[model samples]
Target: MDLSTPPPDLYGRPRADTFFRFLTAFGDRYSPALGGPLLRRNPRRPFSRPTEALQLVVTARRRVAADVVELTLADPSGGPLPGWQPGAHLRLTLPSGRERHYSLCGDPADPADQADPAGSAERSGYRIAVRRLPDGGGGSAEIHDTLHPGTRLTARRPRNGFAFCAEPAVLFLAGGIGITPLLPMVREARRNGLDWHLVHTGRSADTLPFAAELRALDPARVHLRTDDEHGGPPTGTELLAHAPRGAAVYCCGPAPMLTAVQRALDASPAASLHFERFGAAPVTDGEPFTVRLGADGPELPVPADRSALDVLREARPDLPYSCKQGFCGTCEVRLLAGAPDHRDRRLTPERRADGALLPCVSRAAAGETLVLDL
Candidate 1:
């Protein structure tokens, strides 16, 4: 079979052959029969400087809600895990050998929250939660179904894209599983005595993860809205009504909720809005284009349906990439020429003007050829 052109699925998306190869590689590297030595082989790419993958054991697992499962990962060596701040997430290499990013929801400062206090060793652990997405990608389902207590997995240290800022006042709006990253932020706010409030919504009370924990922090400041109870979701205007002018607002949720929040804050003066998305920014069909690697490398064609990262990976498999949805800056490349259709949220307007582009989810303009400093 020609690996380049696989049959398109119902959505007309081409299936890359590299996925199968990755699965084979995953098994060879992580197979239990091979033992700890083989698993110790670092999976970090040369380009992913200062970041490396570590082996973690599942010390505990429990269902937090109807479809959500919370996992506690600890270092097998019984040592403290890497330190992280609020709004940080870990990239775990799953059973299928695919990488998935999950937010760290547990308290970073508390050693007991992360480690086994029973042992004499100063052990620490990291806590993360996953919501099963049956109809969506396979990562969440694999975590819920395959991962368990005593299971071993590989994960990268915490990388934070959504860093919490100290302001006069803070308002957080979360929808469904999006609450994972914001939970720690709310805790830090309270610990520091900063005024903060959280407006969380889900399909129903049963589906809201960490409902009790959030309410315990502060009932008056936390607002819970359920579609089943409220007859519909709360509007962004309603959630932001209590926010004072110039307050810092952070939101994470489904696209609709984020869009609504953006619209609500469009007219507010002096308010700073921050967002963290689990998926790529909504993009229309892109036009076919070509990219030149380095100054003299071959000009590779990027299909409209494929990402630049996929095309570049054909020649450079070592290219660092995680969360290919463009939320992560691992696949960022310097643009020497041509206009980029700036689709990634990670790059600021100034960085885009400075010729920075994330190849994972971004594309080129019509009939434009991009020269990359690969």
Candidate 2:
């Protein structure tokens, strides 16, 4: 029984089925290098997927400015949160235990997207600004008014809904409450030594936070326009009228402001205009529809009268849901079959084409029985 190497038959056996699995993984990463083999092997994989959440307890909370509050979070095991890129957002599940996305405005020195949950203590801290809106009291007010230090809340790993580009020059447009996300981006841009400018539109300097920080950003570069005093909307005639041509324009604010910017940038490079909505997503011409949770199941009726999530809640009050606005992707479910009339703005085009749907507000076409993979 001298079987020093008796397993000669198993040598090539391991390579038979998985002869190219390693190559496949390699080709997947280096797509441009092996684009042919990669696409031919797996053609339908989605470009992006919803993010995952990690439960982080609040270790400390401090007010930095009149509106902005500094919050420190750590892993459930009392370790630091992950390092993230500038303009990245952490999904904060409020005390009411609902989730909302907030931009991190703290140190942008480290950019760790896939940070380890265990050893993230050194890069554990993050900063977010909360402006209490009179009409908005869902979560921001809770963090501002009710929540305190040592409170435990769940946090989704940081995600980049807006990221800076390597363009030679860039223009950042911010309306009243829209500066939160752009704040970090500007800091990071300056750190990277990029040529950038800001157009901040507000009722006045009193209503706008981070005024001094933005003002100190090179007088020749930063422009603060107050409608209450400036007498007009910051527009092509006001803001973009003197915009340096060929710079990427990133705008975020009220729909009206964003639409105006979009219309102006429309004639320019479509690739250069980037926008993100601070409020609910806009999906017009929506019609009533029905969704079947499974095959032969009772088709739940969805009304344009209300959101799909509202209807689902009216039907089953026990179902789990966090954000009804489609930001958290907490209520994510797979589509077993049938095409979905996706209305979410968070997901990319490639993802929607993969039959993904957010049950929150999205609907289905007539005669289309939407199936949920939950």
Candidate 3:
């Protein structure tokens, strides 16, 4: 293995590879630099890296769909912004202290390269779209309701778990706002004159953002399917009809749609599927456990259907957590007792051995009781 070339991160972004991968995966407390610090089980602040986060201003905001809004973010100074490839997403820290990931929907090239005769302030910007969820954890709602032009926000570097694969034959499947990441992929495919087709499905035309813009690229290749027009949602088999025998399939959508597409892929074993989910992954084969906030604290029952983070937050509402999927390492707490299942993608074995566990996705063994330093 090439030590210089780190492996893909938890999100699978190839360009996001870094030496930290080695430190996190193999390093112990004795390891130097990133490892020693990372393995510290009881740091005052968990994975705090304020300097790496960019403070950006909202240069523009517009409602692109019924409940989706597109935002253009740029550095406060007129300077070149970081370049990202298709399928990248920004880990945005909202003013309300909530963090949410939004796909980079705009062109990958920095806007600074394009000359604007009118001296528009759109230089060096990254664009993202958010769909307001009435029942979500308040991140999306806060973004839709409060963010506007001139508003400032913090965003980590772009990470792409769903990197685009430039296959000879490509089929893109997008459901509703899931089109954000796939938009740039389609553009890249078109720009390269690759053989590709896109099937965008939604509840209706108004719910799909950039519908007209996508259609304008290639009306014949871009297929728009809506429940209102199509009578009902298409089956997995029906949707797979658009693909060639060995075409690569990229899909981002609601859980049901993703599941359907995945199930259909079993029939066409030659074709591969890549997907990205915006919500917490459902607990699978979970076993019940008991958790204590502190040594002498109250013990709470963790059911199979719910995450420990969800239950713990009800008691301690101020518990910090983001990306309940377990990649952010925000809900990491020192484990005082019990063996953790260790399901998160962020923490390394050494860290876990040092008594650290992410409450968001990590849990104890069946019928086991875990003591956390809440």
lDDT per residue for candidate 3 within 174-193, as digits (tens), equals 99999999998898788767
lDDT of 3 at 287: 92
Instruction: State the lDDT of candidate 1 residue by residue for 69-140, as single tens digits.
Output: 999999887777766767888888876776788998987655466455453222388889999988754788
Off-target runs (Cα >4 Å) in candidate 2 are: 1-80, 110-122, 267-271, 291-307, 310-327, 333-339, 342-357, 367-374
Off by over 4 Å in 1: 1-49, 114-123, 268-270, 284-322, 327-359, 368-374
Candidate 1 least-lDDT 10 residues: 1-10
lDDT score, candidate 2? 0.66
**Error at 205, model 1, angstroms:** 0.8
Order the candidate numbers by TM-score, best to worst. Answer: 3, 1, 2
Report lDDT (CA) for all predictions: 0.80, 0.66, 0.81
- State the lDDT at 5 in candidate 3: 40
| C-alpha TM-score for every candidate | 0.69, 0.69, 0.84
TM-score of model 3 relative to the true fold? 0.84
- The C-alpha RMSD of each candidate to the native structure, in angstroms, is 15.7, 11.4, 6.1
